[model samples]
Target: MNDTGRQSRHLGIHIDRTVGEVYAYASDPANLPAWAHGLGGSMERVGDRWVAESSPMGRIEVAFVPRNELGVLDHHVTLPSGETVHNPVRVIADGAGSEVVFTVRRQPGTSDADFERDASAVAADLARLKEVLEFD
Candidate 1:
């Protein structure tokens, strides 16, 4: 792909829970800290957005889409440098349980190392989500 072209990697995990259960829990920004360690361990609502003050990338503002029945939990994270990253996430039924998928896109000018790092982080986050939803 060209340097300016976007590349995405999908990281996912299977959680031993119903789609409704996973959707309800994952769709809430307040519950992010419990499993989304990549986004920080704490968050607070400020007006219409959720702010994470101690994220690995520093402070960031997160805005999630409105709740719906389609199991879409997409959100945008505004970095400290004012760049907003769109994170596409979904929950889908898999047999009696559910699967969660997170799409990580390589931004323009991102190096191969950084892109792989982002993929690793997403994998860890998905694993954490499964652990939280299944064992917690």
Candidate 2:
């Protein structure tokens, strides 16, 4: 009911790692299943693309932004239903560590509770990323 929480939300985590380091690990499509639980499966390379049989979305194709030092990890996911979602993600240096950010778009007509859950999932994903990188 509030305009502020109406359509989109940004969520992230701070990892105790350099921006380039975090960007390098997270930007690799092969690492998705390790941190992104919703996409839990070994994603294989198909030519220039990555395909995964996601836990919830069935088979999907993902395309990540070309590797860069600036920490951009944007990607697109094409679902079995033919719907494509652009995920805006980034890793930024914060003092000696880095911050990873993810944008969750609340699909039109999404309930507030559903949006909140989506944001929570993103936070958990980021936490997993932090755990994986910090423990290494």
Candidate 3:
């Protein structure tokens, strides 16, 4: 938890792949459906923004950090209720592989269990990413 008493957490996975490879896949908005379960099924570009169907949350907007070799994958998600959440993500080299981390911020008035569930969801997505990118 940070000084503001919000449950900001970092969830990550170490993949047996290069940082570039991991970054390439994770940084693509089109690839969100394959791993980002919280963001619903499909996504598309509208004008200069990316929009996705977020199941129960209706359609939401997403914006990603500009492409960079620094492995920064920070993105912003605007919920249906007009709330924007900043998601700080990164892909970094780790020994023979790479580490991908996503930061989940605590929404206003979020309960403890809800926060844990959110972290668990991120971990699950990372596992899905590793499974998809590390195929033999």
Candidate 4:
């Protein structure tokens, strides 16, 4: 059994937009910085994948999965000593509105402090998304 502690936060909102419209925007990695606060760079498409370079983190791969009821963003960030952290951003639609969940799984032997720090960042990202989608 996988016993690693995984931290997750779920944020839901009922926007005045359709599921398709919301999924379209959330599925595009290139539009991340537009809604993700403190994002300092652009997301580029490499072959069939996407990559983004953040302020504190270097380059990282961005994956997208679009479904009838959900959209998922998966990526890994490298830690100080070459270890990697897996972050999954999930978006689920419930009729008119959608729910965004951020799951950050700490690498084995990694400290809880690191997970907390990343969790804060994920929270900010979700807030930014809410502001943009609700306003537009």
Which predicted model would earn the best TM-score?
1
Cα deviation at 117, candidate 2, in Å, is 2.0
How many pairs in model 1 have backbone atoms within 3 A of each other, for residues 3 or more apart or on separate chains, i.e. clashes? Answer: 0
What is candidate 3's local distance difference test score? Answer: 0.87
Residue-level lDDT of model 1, residues 35-112, one tens digit each, is 889889899999989999999999999999999898999999999999999999999889999999898999988888
Question: What tens digits encode model 2's per-residue C-alpha lDDT throughout 24-120?
Answer: 8899889999999877578999988899876577998899989987788999988888988888998998899999989998766678788888889
**In model 1, what is the error at residue 49, expressed in angstroms?**
0.5
| Model 2 lDDT, full chain set | 0.86
RMSD to true structure for each model, in Å: 1.0, 2.1, 1.8, 3.5
Over the stretch 80-136, how does candidate 4's per-residue lDDT look in tens digits? 456655667666676667776666565565566876776677677777777788886
Backbone clashes counted, model 4: 0
Q: Compute the lDDT for candidate 4.
A: 0.63
Worst 10 residues of 3 by lDDT: 1-10
Estimate TM-scores for all models.
0.96, 0.90, 0.92, 0.71
Each candidate's lDDT (Cα)? 0.91, 0.86, 0.87, 0.63
Q: What is the lDDT of residue 10 in candidate 1?
A: 84
Question: Using alpha carbons, what is the TM-score of model 4?
Answer: 0.71
Order of all candidates by lDDT, from best down to worst? Answer: 1, 3, 2, 4
